[model samples]
Target: MSDDKPVHTPLEIKLKLSLERQPLPNISYYQRLVGKLIYLTITKPDIAYSVSIASQFMHSPTMEHFNLVKKILRYLKGSVGHGIIMKKNESTQIIGYCDVDWAGNYIDHKSTTGYCTFVGGNLVTWKSKKQAVVARSSAEAEY
Candidate 1:
């Protein structure tokens, strides 16, 4: 993945992932990779959605799933400097940004949401997660 062309985004928006697919023979490797990615999310929240997408098939990952994870690896390799960086001497301002994806999941058609909290112009925390309930519209999802 070090030599692979880096993508500007963590996940391919057009790619629709589903559960009804051929399973990969090696599950341990996929599990380990996803685990590491999950840990990496602590700093690299940009990959949170990508890691969550790959984690859905942890028990029975397919080649497609593995490829999705590989894309994340390539992203990490190319953008080695991207991630959270706390700094001092900035304004003690608290700001947050949140976004929602309307029914982005192909299988469950559930919306996904992500949020980031910044303190003093530095990213302090962030998260991305699928909604628990089905949203009728993007407005409802955001609400």
Candidate 2:
């Protein structure tokens, strides 16, 4: 991946991860890679969602899943030196923003929600996860 062109994003926005893909023979390596990524998420929120998606296939990964992991690595390579920054400031206001894609999961029709929190105009925490329950409408998903 050193020579491969780096992407600005960790994962494709329209990507639909499914379990119908061909399964791989060996999965020990995939699990190890995902485990490291999970640890990385503590400091790199940008790759948190993509890493979460990739880690889902730890039990029985496929070529598509492996490719997604590669994409994440490439993204990391391109985004070196990019991470949360804390600067001296007096602003103390807390702000948050969140959004969801209604019925994003092709398998179960569950929505995926992403959120971020900022303190004094600086990001402090963020998360992206699939909803446990299916949402009937976009408005419901937002709520």
Candidate 3:
């Protein structure tokens, strides 16, 4: 994959992934790759959501999951220098923004909540994770 062309996106838009698909023989490899990607997310929040999705299939990855992982790697290769940079500021206030997708996961019908916190004009933390319980309505999901 050294010569593989870089991709602009880590995961395809509106991608529907499932666990019912055929499992890959080399599950260990997939797990290792996902573990590394998870570590990378510490500095590269942009890839956090895609990496989280890939991590879900660590126990039973399919070719589709592997392809998505490769796409993430390609994206990393292209944007190797991309990362959050903190600049010194006099202000110390922290601001946060959050949102949720209504039933974003087609497989489980669970919404995904995403939030980011900024301190002194620099992004300090962010996360995107699936909700534990299914929301009955979009308002509930957003809440």
The superposed Cα distance between candidate 1 and the true structure at residue 77, in angstroms, equals 0.8
Where model 1 places Cα greater than 4 Å from the true spot, the runs are none
Top-lDDT candidate index: 3
Q: Compared with the true structure, what per-residue lDDT tens digits does model 2 show for residues 1-143?
A: 67999899999977987788899776898889889989999888989988988886789899889999999999999999998888879999999999888898776898989999999989988889989899998999988
lDDT at 104, model 3: 85
Higher-scoring candidate on TM-score, 1 or 2: 2
**Candidate 2: where are CA atoms >4 Å away?**
none
Better of 1 and 3 by TM-score: 3
How many backbone clashes can be found in candidate 2? Answer: 0
Model 1 Cα RMSD, Å?
A: 1.5
Tens-digit per-residue lDDT, 79-122, candidate 3 = 98899999998999999999988998888899999999999899
The C-alpha RMSD of each candidate to the native structure, in angstroms, is 1.5, 1.4, 1.1
CA lDDT of 8 in candidate 3?
86
Query: Residue 42 lDDT in model 3?
Result: 98
Clashes within 3 Å, all models in order: 0, 0, 0
Deviation from native of the Cα of residue 135 in model 2, angstroms: 0.9
Question: By summed lDDT, which 10 consecutive residues of candidate 2 come out lowest?
Answer: 99-108
lDDT (10s digit) by residue, model 1, range 1-143: 54678777778876798677788988999999899999998888878888999998888888889889988898888778987777896599999999998988888888989888988998888878899999998899998
